[model samples]
Target: MASTLKAVGRNVLFGLLMAAAFPIALAAQPSHPSQKVTVLKVNNGQEVLVEINGEGRAVRLACIQAPLEQQQPWANQARTALSNALPQGSVVEMELRARDVYGRVVARLLKEKIDIASPLISRGHVFAYDGYLGRCDDLNYPRLERQAQRSKAGLWAVEGGVSRPWDLIEASGRQTQP
Candidate 1:
């Protein structure tokens, strides 16, 4: 009985030491942040799941939403650009700003592996999404959009150009706050 208790105590002490050395709180703490990620899937029209270090989860792009899967003139180019930016297993450092009820992390997408939010804006993919109007004005954005439209890139390639996600969501009788 005495020997058994001593062995158990030693095991307990070892366990405690290990835990103290590396607390459970420290688990999954990213060594760095990624603003971009692999397009795990275009979940629905507004949101997507991206992988950070092979672990997948949903991330809400900060400014504009790409065209939902069904919407014609959808930002197909945006999706393609994003896909190219973050290929599978590509390291995308994200700075998680917050979480929505949908269990998605809201963040500013990066450029050149930085948290610039330039990619979404420069491409004219989103209209400086009202939630972030102050950040980038719609003036030059339209120009960029025009450029894309001229090139028939992605959604622009569509004959009438891509209908904004807001228009589609509203047409569908869904929320259109953006």
Candidate 2:
């Protein structure tokens, strides 16, 4: 009981710190035209390190959420899928949406005009992020996710898909305030 209380306190403190440190408002507007950028590395399923203007930047893929590392094979598989899609040194078009609290660019990535998040959602490698769909194609993403769920693809192949990343974080005594 004492440990649980401590965990809760830590989570609350962390949330307060995050909220105070990054208070920038995110605009729910369409992103700017695509800008060519080189992929530096795949950070996870929904994020990557890229080079823009000869400077390194972290980009969070908009409209999707993938398994967290603690979720094991699914997380690794999601990361691998993203890595395959955006291999190191590969140049892609990035449509900038907004900067996230962590200072990562939240954007939609495209290769040959193909929206990368589409395939990931359709394959069930990631969940259509419902929380922040204001800047995305709200309808299309959820539709793709539903189709993937119906077909039991990728992470959804199990009896039920793995716990959502945010839920997993919450279960671990962490707060996902974004």
Candidate 3:
């Protein structure tokens, strides 16, 4: 009985130590800080050059894939839509995610507290990027895409939506994720 009581006391002490250390460990870890950035240019439907912390950074919109330049009219339309949404000099909150191989910051952008990708996806200007949707609302994005298809909005106005940018990239022998 004494040995059991000693073991229980050790376990409780260990638990208290871990509980106290956890917050300290979390505080030491680097955090992704959201910053207000000014839009410098819209590179495409899903990418923008923005000025953040006084440096110009290229940021790709997370969780949505836009029509590629080679996709013609749809591509231009998507770009125009994005440009309208984030015109030069407009400020947006940028939530940084991962950086891509091309040195672009993959991020979610918000204006007026509304997620920019949500509107773009709902409008059918872009598709819900399936493979690279970590930390995004995967279910809602696809649902919005489906709704756009049903309503025949933007790219979905055609019999079938434009070919996915990834598909075209693959056909062109590029293995990079867009």
Q: For model 3, what is the error of residue 133's alpha carbon versus the real structure, in angstroms, after optimal superposition? A: 5.9
Off by over 4 Å in 2: 1-31, 175-178
lDDT of 3 at 24: 100
- Could you give candidate 1's per-residue lDDT for residues 15-91 as a string of tens digits? 99998878655763443244556556644333457786678887776655666656544456556556655555544
Better of 1 and 3 by lDDT: 3
lDDT of 1 at 129: 57
C-alpha-based local distance difference test score of model 1: 0.58
Per-residue lDDT of model 2, residues 32-135, tens digit only:
76699999999999999999999999999987898888788998988989999998999999998778877888888999889888999998889898666367
lDDT of 2 at 154: 93
- lDDT (Cα atoms) of all candidates against the true structure: 0.58, 0.85, 0.86
Residue 24 C-alpha lDDT in model 1: 56
Task: Give the TM-score of each candidate.
Answer: 0.52, 0.77, 0.78
What is the per-residue lDDT of model 3 for residues 3-50, given as tens digits with 9 covering 90 to 100? 999999999999999999999999875465688999999999999999
Assess the local accuracy of residue 125 in candidate 2 as a C-alpha lDDT between 0 and 100.
Answer: 89
Model 1 RMSD in Å is: 13.1
Clashing pairs in 2: none
